[model samples]
Target: MRKDVVPVSSPSPLPPLSPPAGPPPCPPARRVSLPAARPVRLVLCLSPVLLAGCWALADRPVASEGASRLAAADPGWLLAGAALTCLTWVAAACVRQGSLPDKLPPGLLLASQFAAGAANHVLPGGLGAHAVTLRFLRARGVPLDRATASIGLYSLARSVTRTLVLLAFLAACPARRRLGELVPDGPVPVPAAAVAGGALAVAGVLLTVVPPVRRPVTGLVRAALADARAVHGRPCRVLALWGGSAAMPLVQAGTLVCVGTSLGLGLPWEQVVLAHLAAGTAVGAVPAPGGLAVDAALVWTLVSFGAVPAVAAATVIGHRVLNDWLPLLPGALTLSALIRARAL
Candidate 1:
């Protein structure tokens, strides 16, 4: 019997199917120890308390003296001075804004200025504030060249405007024209020339000696000039930059004037204001951070104008306590917050 040839179609072998790769073995988890992060967290939590405790222990005597002086002072005038002091923050914020082309969070900007006052007291020559602002704008994505240029503009405008304001006040107010009384009775020209010449020589020597910094110096010069041109192109920016700078000194002096009056400082009002301007100008180049030089200068100037020494000291102390000392802690905390947010 011939078996019919049967074609057996072997079932086609099934194509191999593989399961989806499970997340490629998740390269071993980073073994982050909680201990590593705790110390930082702990420090952040405790810094304020420690700072306050140290300040309290150190400043009790000064605080007592200041409190006594303020207690006896005219509350109305002191209050007005404080109110004006607050306005100075607003003015500072305005100046900072004018320095940058990009708009920043207004609340943060205002807070920065307030915080900057603390920095001014802590660091020499406004370096602390400058550092904070530079960092802030950099975080905001501003170009380094432009941010640096803004700083230059702010500084130049502040110095130049201050001088202009001082001159204008002396010219318009004949009462203040007696600013010559500030100098001792001698030929001022010789000493003045000597000082100027000495300063110029020192600056020239430094620039000549430091060749490496010249590259940045050159770039900064160009950037500053460019920013100046850009600012002039916008009238609002011009006003904010110059106007805010111009008003800053006046408001600051006004605080001193108010404090002096509250404590019965016996000088013409213009004389008090002029005294503040003159003293600040004199010690401005000194690296005395905060108001150390300035406070002494104010006290001396008031004494020269026939105010009682104790009373003058009290006024200076009171003003310092209000503007510089009181706000430090909160300002520091604000600075810390900004830093954490990467806005500083």
Candidate 2:
């Protein structure tokens, strides 16, 4: 026992562990690219509005005329007009959101609407905006069929509301009835209408003949109708859909009033509103990009309302600069950004 104890002295304590080779060089101080990205991001952020302004100024006489009128414009009235113009965009956004069943981020929804304004100018019949919005809704994870349905519902609602609002105004202001006589006596061309109908019929026949086109179209129509019914079932959606649509034309009319006032066009306010609504309804369906026909009709309508020819021309031209052309640049910019972000 004594021999065993002498041989088996307790194991000596182990030495302490040392720091790992100078802390492994402190992980090479990772470089952050945040600063580099900042200025680029800032430029991108500002480019849209700047682009919009520059593009607006590029339109030779329209931009120059608008600027001239703005310079002499009663600051108060011009400010009001600007405010109303801004609200029209908001209304458009609200309608879009309301039409969708899936919840959308308000900011993005608003952005899509802002972008849509430019697209309307690019394609006749609002094809560009419709295309953008359809893509946007799909990006938001809405089913393709429902998105299509919602867009259809939105357009239908807008067209109907415009008519209803016009009717309401006509009911309220009987004096505006006299202006209806200004509608030209020229008959619509039967041959043109017949040709358009023939083309549509041929297209329909082709759709029926082509399985690829027919299947998806049939499914889309069914899905869309179902979604539309679902949307109509919700009262809040209904209100937003129709209410926002109804307010838009009124705001547009208000924009015209402000423009007229700026140009010293001495006309009855109600008459001006009536004239705009009437002209819009008359020429809105024609496939003219930027509504050349609508612009002409508006000028003619104003002249019929006893506005001087020069004043009528100037007013329509100025409002076109504001309502249509002004939004194009910013809208295109927004569209580009949205595409990059995968939101369109």
Best-matching candidate per lDDT? 2
lDDT of each candidate versus the true structure: 0.79, 0.81
RMSD of 1: 5.3
Candidate 1 residue lDDT tens string, 185-223: 778789879999999898778777888766777787788
What are the runs in model 1 whose C-alpha is more than 4 Å off?
1-35, 41-56, 174-181, 184-211
Q: How high is each candidate's TM-score? A: 0.81, 0.78
Candidate 2 Cα errors over 4 Å, as ranges: 1-58, 175-177, 189-211
TM-score of the candidate numbered 1? 0.81
Worst 10 residues of 1 by lDDT: 44-53
